[model samples]
Target: MANRGRLFWKILLGFWLIFLLTTQLLWAVFTLYNPRHEAPEDNIARRIGNVQIGTAGAVLARGGLQALEELKASWPPDERKFFSDSPVVDAPPQGEGALPSMQQTRGAVSRLVMAPDGQRYLLRYDLDGLRNEYHQGRRSSILHMPPPLFWLGLTGGLLFSLLLAWNLTRPMLQLRRAFERVSRGDLSVRLFPVMRRRHDEITDVAKDFDSMAERLQVLVSDREALLHDVSHELRSPLARLQLAIGLAHQNPKNVYASLDRIEHEAGRLDRMIGELLALSRAEHQGALGEDYFDLLGLVEAVVNDARYEAQVPGVDIQLTAHQPEDYTVKGNAEMMRRGVENIVRNALRFSAHGQSVFVSLSRVDSLLEITVADQGPGVEESKLSSIFDPFVRVNGPLNGKGYGLGLAITRKVVLAHGGQVEAFNGPGGGLAIRLRLPHWE
Candidate 1:
């Protein structure tokens, strides 16, 4: 779980950094390309070059350097042009490499001077430096930007990306801790609701995690109850067996009765274990064995099988349906049958002898409704909710003289088929168990 958050942040930061760096570099490149807008083969620069050539000619005339060169006096044409009329000042370095008039315009000429080699120079008289004055009017060159601006942008983008990563990962970290605790046997922990988004994917994930954790806690609690009930159930049979052994060694006449009690208790234990096993199988298989069955026929079969052991002397169970033999529903056959039998058995046990028990099979809308009603005393209103809990015997000893796992197992079976079971006092008198199942072909 921790790994999930880490992976999310890594991918988030990786993509964001990639996009940030690439976009920043692209912007720099476009800016660099925008300023190289020099016109090709310009005429202004050519006129500037001719002006320098003419200036070079005047410099040659002032000293008659051409005549000295023609006489072969071992003097350079530029050396003869040195003026003796006034003491010469030192020139800026590389006056010989100055630009021609074609490269220097009217505004550029003021900063330029012609040398004897037909070259123009941008001579800054006040500055007396070799560097050109780049800050002239209407022809400003690109200025170098300060280096800190790029650093500022990079730092800001990184901070924003990290903030986004945190927002995406914080709730995941909290959820991981909750899941870890639950996995390690702490079923009470809950994930902190750090993500408050109503419709986003993260919010959906959070809600699902909360729901799963809640369900897990309920299951864990139910398992604890099952373990407790099983242990208590085992003790009774073991105690009976111990008493029977003690009696057999002492009193032969009472041995049979003691042994019979032991056998009966052992049988109860076997049946309880079997019911629990069946419930477990039903839960594990889920809907694997689901198929359509006639609801009325299924109920009738369950009624006959459950009452095979004994029947109440004065109760009449009638099956009434709007339509006969066609109220089919989708469910596991054995589990559904047992579930119906449990409800019928419960009604038979609770209702008074010689009283009527009504078994109704019908469909309401899209549901198959099977109700077991009896004319017996009912339980407290609050006990209705917990009546289906395992080992919950509201009527003391039932007809089978066994623990009350039937209703619990019955509830489990009903739930596996996407159905619901409910208990309430009948409208007239006594209690009713209603089973509602989804109907399908």
Candidate 2:
């Protein structure tokens, strides 16, 4: 649950820390690599020693009286260690082959650092000389290398932070544009967000919003179409029936039949109106599944009412219960019974003579399942969905039958009750219409 400000600062601080750490490392290495450790190239002792070393070798070879007498007569005993008297190394006087050996421990003033040849040596230097040479190298390295890499890293990090900010802000802009489109009544807007492989909650929220917008678009479109079609269809039957009733006195019995037909059409039209109203209300009713009614009683009443107008095909309503008692449901009872009646009526309308219209209401797992089936020619699979749409008829062109709002009404009622309705081909070659409602066990 990291907050936005916290996350932003975390990333910014992360980049800044990297730049600072790298610069510090480079600065440390530059400071530590002083060039004073290596041996100097040339020294003052080498030049001074080259002139005196040869003469001192000869002077020590004839050291019987002249060398020792000269060493004591001219050389000061206090300065004997500072100045070498001779370099006849390990010589012995009056021996077969030997030279005088005199050694002194003077300070390392360009000390004769032997080149390891045991015959020649390189002269070296002291503290003041080492410091003066090392200072220049250390100063130059510090002045040049560390500053450039540090500034380069700083600049790169700043640019990187900017690029990262741009990357994050771009997706937000896309979502804004999508919202703008939706505001202007284009509801099909979708966003294709660009991100790394990680999944964040913001991405999930955007997806959920997109899904909600899609459902809203579909429902609005359907409602608009339903309104237009209902208005258009209602006007026709109402105008015709009014005209037919206005002229009902020409032949008494035939006029009565005309009125009855008009009444039937009027009743059908009224049912359509009621269904459309229910559809409208259900869209806004939220959830109202508190009411429970007997599913068996509802189906029985609807089927018996359907038998009144059923002449061509006799109504054969059957109820098969796994349990003997009536199975009740939690729904609007009147609305649910009307829904079932529409299905039974439609089945009776389409079925042939002696063909049965079967109905079953049962309870299974806290669900009341009602199935109304008929031995009529089953609807085509393609037309099944269309038939649920208002004014879409399953009757062929030859049979100009009732308005096709029955199934649509049934679907509306089922949905309002938090239930589902479906149609399919029965196992034994018939149209099987089923409704499922939540029931109290």
TM-score to native of every candidate shown? 0.73, 0.56
Off by over 4 Å in 1: 1-9, 32-101, 104-149, 197-199, 285-288, 304-312, 324-326, 398-400
Per-candidate clash tally? 7, 3
Residue 154 displacement in candidate 2 (angstroms): 4.0
Residues 1-441, model 2: lDDT tens digits: 143445455566677677667776766676578565333432333333333343434443344325534754564554333333322334332333332232222223332221112222222223333344445453344434545566776787767765665556556666777788888989987653443233776577577768878897988899789878878888988887877776776556569778787987788788767766765554443544567777777776777777766654555656565668657677577667777888887888778778888888776676778888888888888887787787778666225555666788788888877788899988787799988887766
Q: Looking at model 1, which ten-residue stretch has the lowest summed lDDT?
A: 123-132
lDDT of each: 0.66, 0.64
